[model samples]
Each structure stands twice: as structure tokens, then as C-alpha cells.
Target: MTIPKELEKILEITKEQNTWRRKETLNLIASENVMSPVAESVYMSDYMSRYAEGKPYKRFYQGTKYVDEIETLTMDLMNQVTSSKFCDMRPISGTVANAAVFRVLANPGDKALIAPVQAGAHVSHTRFGTLGALGIEHIELPFDKENINVDVDKSIKMIEEVKPKFVVMGGSLYLFPHPAKELSPHIHAVGAKLVYDAAHVYGLIAGKAWSNPLDDGADFLNVSTHKTFPGPQGGAIFSNNEDYYKPVSRTIFPWFVSNHHLHRLPATAVTALEMREFGEEYASQIVRNAKKLAESLASLGFKVVGEHLGYTKSHQVAVDVRPQGGGAKAAKTLEEANIIVNKNLLPYDGPEAVSNPSGLRIGVQEMTRFGMKEGEMEEIASLFKKVLIDGKEPSQIKREVMEMRKGYLSVKYTFQDGEWEQKFSSKVIPMII
Candidate 1:
């Protein structure tokens, strides 16, 4: 019994990445998270090999009874967590979720207002992405630079003037809550629907650490399950509005998605149940850690954004890294030191700055799941300063970073037993192999 050399190499690389990302490095990428061992185990089930297209109990394929039950359970858990009357656990990714909603709500030539790219709108909401593919006219909502949110008065005026088919709220670089409450009434008055893409903060809302956009008058809530939600890599749409349920669900299957990745259902269900139990504490600590990280970075002369608004209410913190050779260079340099982050466009960064944006987006949710706290956030900021400000060698910083990560290797706030390695070895890895 011998493994092929090429296959061996692939396994080696995956093992390396698993060890590097899971054990050694500090992940600050705002869009990333680690699933709990229980969820991870479920993610590797035989369901991965199956397909259950269309909705539960009505599938295009047979032999889907259990799959249907799992999906139904998952949707039920999603409804419970989101407090929405209807939930669809289908769209394979966040962008796909956006596409389904767009397909149902707007015609090809209809106008849709979205948060500006500089203000954190995901590409799916812009002309360069899905909206463009659908021939929908995408317009930017006015952004208030000093406040780091939508220009409510101007946006309301724009909504009246343009009268778009729908207005999209929420974005990837979200800091504070959007003015959904303020603008929803205005959006509806103009005969437009309000949609919130809560991909980054879905878990926060579920945990009650942030406001639910549905509660703030949004007609639909879309999310990617992987980010702060700590589920499988998939997407979901939730809403209380009965009118949207049938159309949106049908659009999701025959139009935007097929098969729907049945494996994600049980994993998502487990994560949803876990969130119901530990999400409040996990989400609260994530925000607290983010605020502390922002303050520490600002104190270290990093020009952290949104200081006047108490840094952040979510899991993210943004820093202007132009002073230390710009975000592109700074992010790469941090990676060399085993600290992961992504370059992002600040509101002031023009379209030309997309390739070399002046800002870095950092999220503390994964680390918070690893049981790191406010004090640890300060230490992480020091690591950033050493690498970016002091111009210390990244190799030197990497050693210290690895040492610092030694104690906080276990994933917390879930129903897993013992240290992460022990739990993975005894429970997840054995089951998978």
C-alpha cells in the first residue's frame, strides 16, 4: 500500500496549511473563522457525496429522505437563531445568496442602490459582479466619511430621486451598525425593498451583540455562514415576509443554485445550535477585543479608524497602514510574521486605490473563539508595531508570534472536549480518516 508521490505532496501541503493556519498564525482576516470540532466533524460526513436539489420533501433526485430531514432541521435551527418566520439554507455562497435576491426583486434594467465599494459593499452588490452580470443598474449610496456610515439624509434623498427597485445595506468592511432603521422607512416609501447583507456580522446579530437588520425594517437578510457565524462555507436567506418566501426559495434552486451542498446542512445545524448556546458570550468578547485592538493600534500611532465612535461595535477594526508603507505592503509583511490580515479600501480611498488601498481590515472573532481577550489584543497590536513600525525582521517576529500562540491553541465557546489538538485527534480526525 503506497501513496502516489503527487498525492503525497498534496496531502503534505494541506497538512502544512492546517498546521500553519490553525496552530501557528494569528488570523485577522475579517472574512474568516474556524469551525468548532463538532461542526468540523459533521462537515466531513457522507452527505458530502450526496445531492438534494430543490426544497425538503420535494427533490429532483430520490434517496434524499434523511437529507431532507437534515435540511428541514437546519432551516428550523436557522429560523430559531435568526428569529425569522422563513429561512432558506441553500445558496452555496454569499454572492450566490445576493444573486438570488437580485433575480427575484429586480429586472435586468432596474436600478439597485448599494453601499459603495469604499464603504465595504461586497463586489456582488456592484456592477463589476453579479449585479452587472444580471444587467442591473448599480448605484452607490452616499457615504459619510467622518461618521464611517451611510449619509442618511443624502441617501434618503437619493432613494427618492432614483427610486431604485431595492436598496442594499451592510458590507464587508462594516464597523458600526448601518442606518437601516433610519433608511428602511424611506426606502419603502419610494416603493423599494430593503435588503441587508449581514455576511460579516450574522453571528453577532444571532448572538444579540448587534442589531438584527430585519428588526430594523429590512425585508430580507442574507449571509455567508463561514465568516463570523462559524459554520460551513455556504449562504442563507432569512425573512419574516411571507410574500418573498416562495419566490426567493424557487429562485435559489432552479436559478442561482443546484444540489445546494447537502453536507453543509448538518454542520450548519450543529453550529446554529452551538451559537444558540455560546454565541452571546463569544460575540460580546469579539467586539470587546476589536475595540481594544483598535485603541491599542491607535495608541501605537497606527491611525486606527473610527476613534470618535469608540472604534467598533462589531468584530472588525480598520487601520490606516499608509504611513507604514501602505496596506498592500503591510499586509504581506504581517503574513511573513505569521499575522494574517487583508488590505481594504477606506472610504477616502478612491477607485484607483483598490490595488494598493491605504487600510487594513482586522477581525478578532477567530481569536476570540480561541479564547483570546482584550489584553491579548493589545499584545497582538505590539506584534504589528514590531513588524510594521519598528521595521524588525519578520523571521524574528515569527518566532515570538509562534511562542505567543502556544497557549491559545484550543478553540473555545463550543461543545468540544479538551484541547483543540486532543479533540481533533480523538474525535474529528479519527472519524474523518
Candidate 2:
């Protein structure tokens, strides 16, 4: 097929420029992941043309019969993946899933306990988030420095004192597994419901890497697909109880969104099914990679957050970068060398702005998925130390990064004997290292 002159020029530019850019950037962002070729293929299908406006059974637009199937399949996959009685795939992002939970569970003035953003809570549940703006009282959870987990005793005291309407657990930078089930009884002592934000650990849980929040007695659970789940960018909500279905569906539909992209649904559903089969392997590898990276980084005299395995029960590893000019300067210095990471705030950070905090949060998910194991992590950490500790030139580091990335040909996951599938396979889940 001959390409038209006009489209050909655009294609040429896209192929020459953006393609290489994607190839070069070493994505260590904890919340991001490269979707399988199969997942990407589904996004570009005819389903993308649909404009369904409601749930699977009913819609405001015609030609939604197929979209209905896609929605149902997505829901079923989410249920299986999370083991929830009610799972809704309508929320466009994890934030929206959380919003839906807040809408259904808390009144305008009701108090909702959450971890402070500096303490590693996501914005969705923080006082800086929608929860605070919508008249929902925000109570920040405390962490135990010795154990690096939520201080359930302190939180229980706060719950009794505040009488919060809902108690939220989990966050973006939480390295340790949340004791939601054990803590739920304490929250209920003050008539509060437990909501677990499993965004970071969804893939880990599916991989049997960490315990599931639902099984741990959380009433509500919210997660994003792009993180450790290794799926298309999307969000999902699952509940231990079926009664939340209607309220959640309502909050997601007319109240929060309309015509939830049918194209994204099929892609997300396919990703979910893939996760159900191969997620355990993928997720376990992520943890193993993180563990290796943390150990390597710590061995280099870097201040790693959790010295123990359970302290970082998932993929994230946070390092205090203040000794090396804080997170902002460190991030810029590293980025100039073609290495990417984000500045973050630690629990004990004494008043650093969110944009320019004192720590660097790193992850091994992308590298792990790309087939880089312990040795590679050690190499990356050595590079990191050389650049930061040895004071190597930023440009010199970029050249090294370019060479390092070249060794890994592509980001796509491969199957048996190079017969690579375009999407994730639930059965291909990797074992924990």
C-alpha cells in the first residue's frame, strides 16, 4: 500500500523522532508501565469508535452491544483479579475511583483518615486532594520509624479522638504492606469503614506477592492499571460487598464521567485478563528487581528507606537524596544524564514543598519487565553512585545510559522461543526471586 504524500510526511516525522525518544528514555517512574503490544492493538481497534454512555446493559447511544460485552468482560476480569464482590471499571483514573468511594461512603462534613502526602499518601486521599476540598475531613495517618509501617495504635487513638466517618489505608510510596484487616476492627470501633487504595500493589497482589486488601477486611479498594498491573492506563474499584455497586456505578457514570471510552474498555479488559494469567510472574519480578536495586543502592552508601523486605513489600524504593543536594538537584543532575526519577517527600521531611522535596523515589518495574535482573540493578546503582557520589559529568552519564539501554533491545515482553504475544498472559506470571 502506497502512503499518501501528506500522511507520509507526518508518519516519517513520527517514525524518526518520537520512536527513538520512547526507545531512549529509561522509565523508572513507579506509576508508569509499557502496555503489551496486544493491549496497544486493542486500543486502536474499531471499538475505539463507539460512544456508549451508560453501563453494559443500558446506554444512551446505539451500537453499544459490543461495548456492553467489553464492559462486562472488564468487570469480570477485575473481579477475578481482585477477588471482589463488586468491581467497576468505569472510573477513568484511580483518582476517580477514589472519588466514587468518597461520594458513596462519606458525607460532606464526614471525617476521612488518610496518610499525609509527605508521609507517602496519594493526592486522592490527602488533605491536598479532592477529599479535603469536598468538605470531607482529612485525618493524616502516622508511621512508625522503627518498623516503617502504619502506627496502628496511634491511628486508633486518632480515630477515637476524631470519630472519622471513614478510615483510608495505603498510598503511593508505602513500601510496607498495610494491615488493613487487623486495623479494620479498630476503625470500626469508632464506626469507620476501611478503604484500601491498592493502586501501587494491585499487580503485586495479583501476583500473590502481597496480601489482598479485600481478603484483609477492607470494605473498598481502588487501583490503577498502569502501575504494577502492567496494563493500559485506567482505574478500577472493587468492593467486598455487593451493595456498593449501584452507588459506585452511579458516581462513576453521570456524576463523574460520560461515554466511558469503549476502546479503552476492551484494551483494559484484555490487559486485566492478561494480568490474571501472567501478573503473578510479572509482579513477583518487579518486587525481586526492587529488592535487588535497593540492596545494591544501599550497599553503595545510599540511604535506602527500608532495610528489611517487609518494609518494602512492593516495588518502590525511596532514597534520601538530601546528602546529594536534595531531590530536586539530584533529579535534574540524573535526568541530564538520561536517567529519570522523581523528587519525593519523606515522612520526617521538615517543610519541603511538594515540587522540591528531600527524597528520590525509585522503582524496578520497567527494568524488571524488560528482563533486567539483579546484575543489571547493581550496574544501574553503580552508575547512579558514580554520577552522584563520584561526581561524574552529566553528559558522560548520558552516554553510559545510552549504551546501557542499547543492551536491552526492546521493552516488549517475550514469550516462548521468541514467539512473543502482543499482550500479557495470566499464565506467564513469573515466580518470586
My TM-score estimates for the predictions, one after another, are 0.96, 0.90
Question: Could you tell me which 10 consecutive residues in candidate 1 have the lowest summed lDDT?
Answer: 423-432
Q: Give the runs in model 1 whose Cα sits over 4 Å from its true position.
A: 418-433
Tens-place lDDT per residue, model 1, 1-433, is 8989999999999999999999899999999998887888788888889988888999889999999899999999999989899999899999999999999999999999998776789899999999999999999999898888889999999999999999998999999888999999999999999999999999999999998999999999999998889988999999989897679988987887878888899899989999999989988988899999999999998999889999899999999999998999999999999999999888788889989999999999999999999899999999999999999999999999999999899888888765644645554443444
TM-score of 2: 0.90
Q: On a 0 to 100 scale, what is the lDDT of residue 7 in model 2?
A: 100
Report how far residue 63 has shifted in candidate 1, in Å.
Answer: 0.7
Clashes of each: 0, 9
Global lDDT of model 2: 0.78
Model number with the top lDDT: 1
